[model samples]
Target: MTDSGLEFDLTRRIGGFILRGRASLPACGIVSVSGSSGAGKTSLLRAIAGLDSGLSGQVRFAGETWHDGTCRMPVHRRRIGIAFQDTRLFPHQSVAGNLAYGAARAPAGTPGPDRAEIIALLDLHPLLKRAVAGLSGGERQRVSLGRALLSRPRLLLLDEPLSAVDTARRNRLLPDLRQLLLDHGIPALHVSHSRAEIAQLADHVLPVRDGQCGACHPLNDWLAAQDASHPFSLLEGHLAGHDTENGLSTVRLGEASLVLPGLGEVPAGASLRLIVRARDVALALDPVPGLSIRNQIPVRIKGIRPQPGTAYCDLDLALDGQVLTARITRAAADSLSLETGQSVIALIKSATLDPAQE
Candidate 1:
């Protein structure tokens, strides 16, 4: 896994914009490239896949050399499969025909991917005979993925695969993509601007900024560092049990139970990533009984940092030693007489945590 997944050192100048970035992607799973608009994410993908001829850099995947300036490979010769946000399927072709387009591209003598495998991976079985133009947005995107996988690519490059669909459809298709990466062990370079997409799909994250590739970091930790105004904390735990009567899922953070509501149909023993916002956490002196908050973990106040008009308190929950931050007004802090070395309960609602399948 430490082997460099993808590398680029070329530069391209487009009018007033200079697109240049160097990064090393992991050798397995999804290595996500993220940035603001106009940060050259798509251009970078094209450069890596040999689709952009205007760039100058050595692009290498595994031990194979792709571009070395003098000898430039054509797109068709790259053996790389690319799937964009748009399905770009042939309007006149049937779904099977569209998929066969990629299937036909496999190298001579190599067995192509099975139709059922592609269909099951992307849930495209029902629409196998449907016309490309008749499929819905999500279905078309799934078919596009199937076509790309059937191409038998050495590397798969996806540029905002879910961006073209509506939010609801995007949510529906993400899990399928996740299963593809995990179950099939296909390595991918997934480009996106959405944090949630990266959280759900990426096992390794490469954050691109200012036309330069930065160091790799874990997806959750990198997301927490994005904003200083409202820093976030991450808790990684397994779904220990379910409380169906309360509509809450119990996450086992060491020995404590974190009850969050609206956890829709997650299987037991699945890893859960919980996001506890600083503003949503509250501190208490003793275990109160009359409050609506269900969590009352015994924690020690670690440190209290004060701002101009408010104060930020950091607490270390005993369970897994997870950190919980509470932003309170200066007056509120004074009223509670909060201080370091004090004991409190970290109040949290189940709705605040994102119940995603890891």
Candidate 2:
């Protein structure tokens, strides 16, 4: 019997740089490969995709071996869809032609969106007849992504797939892309440098550092382990109601509620994932009347850690079993006499709350 999911232990040497990666990932959901530049992030993906002949090690997916000591499966035989940052579309092909090429290569009876659905999802209708040479950077990336999805591969590998798209558009597409991957039951290894992208779409994080890829961690666990400088929290809740006059939406998080703006149009009861930066949160001993902050939640101080070099400190606040991180000056924390298990209010500006695609 073979094991399910993806298991890999790959190593490669490029000139003086050596890359080592090992991980056992779930067979579903988006797994993000995150790191800074030249961290061997892409090299790891290439080794798994069978694009690196110099790589040595094993790559097993869903119990099938793609790479091992002597035998090596060809890249095409691996049945994986890949989209790179450079948007490598065929120069001679039109947008439709490029899409058709990917569609033609899809395995028979593969599970995924059909050609028409892909076109619609990427909004490629108008650009279908356009030449690839004329497409903008963002448009090319979209087309490349659409083509990858059209192939209906069992596994997807994306290397900074939306780096060329504007932030607003990328944010809008992330939710739909995440849903699509789920709907099709395609497990993806997504590589990105953006924390926002990983926070919004990744179910798990695979950290690449110093030319090595570490074991996977759940998104929240990974976020909590980071330093206080870029601390953040990911919250999940259902849209409780919308106040049209106030142009705000209330999200129910167990017994607590968070009010946010620009969510009035989101249908009631829709699930939402919110990203709250630690810097954006403030703590108060008592609720202040007529404050500009729209969200004030009752929370308990779970833990506090001081930043060694800075005068600031990090606080772990708990609300109805959910954890929120906050960074405040040591003076303020001392002035209020903050301590573990102490109840306080977490004040968040409505505008500062960024709701990710549900």
Candidate 3:
């Protein structure tokens, strides 16, 4: 099968609220649907997968017509894989058995991924023969992912897989899941209410507003919308090396290096994206050493955004081509004589996180 994009112009009414939106997913990247609870994220995903027949509109994927005014493809025939908050694995079955059940559904003689590749991608080798009853929340999610992949689906659907776990566990699991989606190269639509999950995983974002889905936007815009008071920024970097004595991971963003807490044993050259909040960053006109902070990156001011009811404004700073934001008082801005294209150093709190949140 081709690496096909999915598009839909759908409208569905459940109770008094109506869900209406039109959007498209790229041929080979994860698109995240984001909104508050009961805002139609799951409904939209369900409708796209042919599980909700109440929808009326066109559902097209790649070059094939899955649904329209005159035709509706059978849900089973649509070739989609799904993982939800409730993983619903068979308690009586081993993890391998549950995964194999998906493999068994593949049409004979159709060339697709084998179980071994899927197992490796999800890092399920250890849990292969374990009973599903003993799996943790994160482990269950992994099995669910494996089960979905083993089916050799054309498109994968994830509905709040991380939402089921507690904050701490969710933080650890996000990297693993992001790596899996990237490694498999499967086009997926991930549905979640957590901005952190979307920030960590999505290649593009579709924000759900008032039950209506908005057009997709680049990752930067979605991330920058976190909050006016606590503006968010996205940084791309690679693992420089681990400082075992300090128990930190050095992330190199261009020539700048940040010593982030919690040393993950990632490979030296693995690419990593960090979500930095304005509140986590401090500013200075010159470099100061031997402080509590572990990061002191020299950045040039790109622009400023003012927030209502506060003297603090968000500063958009640049390091090489990467962008970051700092929240500081307007008084500080004047005292430091900060301006667009002005050079400054940003002091990032070492504990800043992608759990971003705990």
Best by lDDT: 2
How high is the CA lDDT of each candidate model? Answer: 0.72, 0.85, 0.79
As a TM-score, model 2 comes out at 0.80
lDDT of 1 at 6: 68
Candidate 1 lDDT, 247-316, residue by residue in tens: 7777778877787765545556655556676677776778889898888777777777776543544444
lDDT, residue 139, model 2 = 95
- Candidates in order: C-alpha RMSD to true structure: 4.7, 4.4, 3.6
Measured with C-alpha atoms, the lDDT of residue 18 in candidate 1 is 78
Q: What is the C-alpha local distance difference test score of candidate 1? A: 0.72
Off by over 4 Å in 1: 1-3, 74-78, 103-118, 208-216, 237-257, 262-272, 284-287, 297-310, 316-345, 350-358
Query: Which candidate leads the pack in TM-score?
Result: 3
The ten-residue window of minimal lDDT in model 2 covers 349-358
lDDT per residue as tens, model 2, 1-358 = 2376999988899999999988899988989998999999998989999998788889999999999998899999998999999989999999999998889889888778888877766778999999999999999999999888888998999999999988766755666677778888999999998876887788999999989888799988886676435777788776789889878888888899988886664457655567777888999999988988878999999999998999999999998878888999999999999999999999975433242322
